[model samples]
Target: MKNIFTIVLLFATLSFYGQDKKISFLDLVGNNIQVPRGCEAQSVYELQACNGTSIKWDYYSTDMLNEVFNATISAFAEGNSSKTEVTFTSFGGQLKGYKFKMGTTFQYFLMGTIKDQPLMINLGTPKDITKSDDLDGFLSLFFDEVG
Candidate 1:
């Protein structure tokens, strides 16, 4: 009985260590974000947030915040009746932005400034996330903040 218990414990320890660990990755543009175990960033602008999700980031002058925001709203609203604002508090901070369903997938846009530069991070996922709670979880999984 003691030998069997020891073997089970050892197996459990090894299994835990063998699994891929989810990591918090800081983007090349100085944004602190999160990615799943298998995803790796290819550049500052485009990255895979996970195996099936895509993330795109861009930077602009702080002065362009309103311009960019309005442009984004108009762009998403064009031909898409589901475009709406989504605001939630995640692990990083309070994120207020827009969300729209493009085709069968959903995309979330978060706009903020870090160190005086306008930062826009877009997260695209296949999940149908329509509630504030779901939006919070989705943002928490991909974005922290631009630090």
Candidate 2:
């Protein structure tokens, strides 16, 4: 009976630790975005109000999709003093992100159509992504479009 109780406790602990560590934040446009847990929402007028130690985001919108995206990426790189090249990745379908290093940390500037409207988001993280799978996992949080 003690062994069975121990096994059950172990299983419960593992299950609790394996749970997803994320919280949802709705953008001004009503699109639900999943941010890392512990992000605190700031005051109005800030699209990227949700701020946390591990991750933060800034959201934008533009009428010209490609042109605006290119200019935004270039401006961000220049502003961050990042001389590195920007790497692009398609998050399946119309969703895509431009990964680059800003200062000492890595950032992903995502651009895609949300509800037929053009949307751009810059996801900033403090940790350096060393593995491809880790980067993928981070980017995957923004994969699904929800309201």
Candidate 3:
């Protein structure tokens, strides 16, 4: 019985460790965002948060981060007017994201260092995709901020 329990616990720990640091679609903006129509996940490039316990924000910079978001927005807007803003949280630190229109459809690019790694969210949009709840949820994952 002890052996069986130990094996089970070990497997559980290994499984959790294997999935240790990954940014899934949910980690992007939590709920209220989904895989939009007319497009599939073209590709995903993930920068792992850490091997052991570590902070996610130390890997990237504000200027480089904003460039990614702004460049995506500009591409979607096709050289039209586009804008982005930087936001910071005491716990989560700095991040950048934006919403824009491409031809007739909407797109979003939300990127930041949350969970102690760089996360870039790029996808088609849902109506009211610009939700404060999404941003708060994204940032709050790092900080112990309430409400």
lDDT of 1 by residue, 1-147 (tens): 999999999999999999975445646255566554566765545667564677776777766866887798788788888877776443444557888888878888877654445667677888765554453443455544422
lDDT agreement with native, every candidate:
0.66, 0.52, 0.44
Superior by lDDT: candidate 1 or candidate 3: 1
Using lDDT as the measure, what is the rank order of every candidate, best first? 1, 2, 3
lDDT (Cα) of model 1: 0.66
**Where is model 3 more than 4 Å wrong at Cα?**
1-70, 82-94, 132-147
Per-residue alpha-carbon lDDT of model 2 for 12-126, expressed as tens digits? Answer: 9999999974335635345455444555444221224233223333345555666777887788667565444333333332546566675666676667655556666566666
Top candidate by lDDT = 1
Error of 1 at 65 (Å): 2.4
Query: Model 2, which residues run further than 4 Å from truth?
Result: 1-24, 28-37, 43-63, 79-93, 128-132, 135-140, 144-147
For model 3, residues 91-117, the per-residue Cα lDDT tens digits are 343445565555554454556665556
